[model samples]
Target: MSVVIPVSADWLTLREPADAAARSHSLARRAARLVHPPAVVHDLGSGTGSMMRWLAPQLPAPQTWVLHDWNADLLAHAAAEPPASVSDVDSRVGHLEHLGADDLSGASLVVTSALLDVLSADEVEAIVAACVRAGAPALFALTVAGRVDIDPVDPGDRLFEAAFNDHQRRVAHGRRLLGPDAVAVAAELFRAAGWSVRTDASPWRLGGDPALVGEWLEGWLAAAVEERPALTEWADEYARTRAAQLAAGRLRVAVHHHDLLAWPA
Candidate 1:
């Protein structure tokens, strides 16, 4: 059995701005062009509805959105803060792997942000199949692309990055996650299913924002250390040095991600 990891509202709130900044606007515009009026959008792993808030305006008005997630609390938060541009919002609290064509029966567009990397290949296939069955275009955004560049580069950057990527791909609760390879796998599946696919880079360039940078640094290093326990001693020193650089406003990081948009050919 695969377990869903609980994501906190605070973390979502913290990353929302960066996510908004990093998403591909041209893809959003293209998605808008693909959908007809009075659109019904389904957002898988919607979280606190940040994706809805960010994307609603780009879509046609009088829109209805079904926000799907495993966390009921987050669903409530999403429902409470509906986007002004949407006509109605519905919340579905369930695992996305169980989603089927019927669940997205009337969808005009299917969307998700920062979600694909955490899903297994089976889960990704299920989503693609659901979209194909429903005849809806799909836009998967902000998937990690296995690249992280930090300015004033340290010798350990590649080491930690590799370990962190390994941790991301680690099997958990009997499921093997796709991690950074999510975009490639999803693109291949979509293309195999005869969909027209387009992908664009959506890297989060972090430098001036101390809060986001600091938090991201901590999480990145933590994951790296978790995967390679032998690096604990060196990671501690590295973390400290990074913290000082962050405080001095000298650290810059480009955490690479990719956005994929697929539509029936």
Candidate 2:
């Protein structure tokens, strides 16, 4: 069975601003130029419709959105909270791997956020192939590159980072996740299939949000300890120091990510 993590709407809402700022403006414009006057966008693994909320104003008006997610509640929330520029909203409840040309049939563009790293190589290939078959431009943003930086650096930072990445690469349900290696593989796969791909740095430079920092830090250390159980001995103290720094406004976080736009050559 897959070890899928359930994300609450509150968490999605909390991260929306950071996501909005980290997305590549140039790439979004390039995608917007693909279709004139109006566009039909299919967002894969859309969480609380943050992708739609971010991209709608950047593109032209009269847009239609089809949001896909495994959570029925998220789908309902997305459909109910259509952006002002959106002409209509449709929700599809399913896994990203099940996405196909048929699902993207009327879409002018495809988009997803913070999703690629958790997917297996085969799943990414399938999604790319489906996009190719559908003749749509795909913009995938905020894919983790397995790099993390925290202010007042601890000597154990690298250890935790490596452990976390190892955890990400773990196989579940017989599929090996690409983890931090996702960006390189995705770019190569798209290119080999005759798609022109452009990429931009979209790192999250986080500070001054203790709540977000605490939550993110908790998840980060949890995964690290899961991969390297030995880290558990040091985890509590490390997290305590980090949390104190964050509370005192002395913490800074830099999480490296990349945004890619793939289209027919």
Q: What is the alpha-carbon lDDT of model 1 when measured against the actual structure?
A: 0.93
Give the 10-residue window scoring lowest on summed lDDT in candidate 2.
1-10
Off by over 4 Å in 1: none
Candidate 2 residue runs with Cα over 4 Å from true position = 1-5
Candidate 2 per-residue lDDT, tens place, 93-198, comes to 8887777799899779999898889899988888888898999889999999899988888998999999999988998789899988887888898899899999
RMSD to native for every prediction? 0.8, 1.3
- Say which candidate scores most in TM-score: 1
Best by lDDT: 1
Clashing residue pairs in candidate 2 (N, C-alpha, C atoms within 3 angstroms): none
Residue-level lDDT for 107 in candidate 2: 79
Q: How close is candidate 1 to the true structure, as a TM-score?
A: 0.98
TM of each candidate vs. truth: 0.98, 0.96
In Å, residue 127's CA in model 2 sits off its true spot by: 0.5
- 124, model 2: CA deviation in Å? 0.6
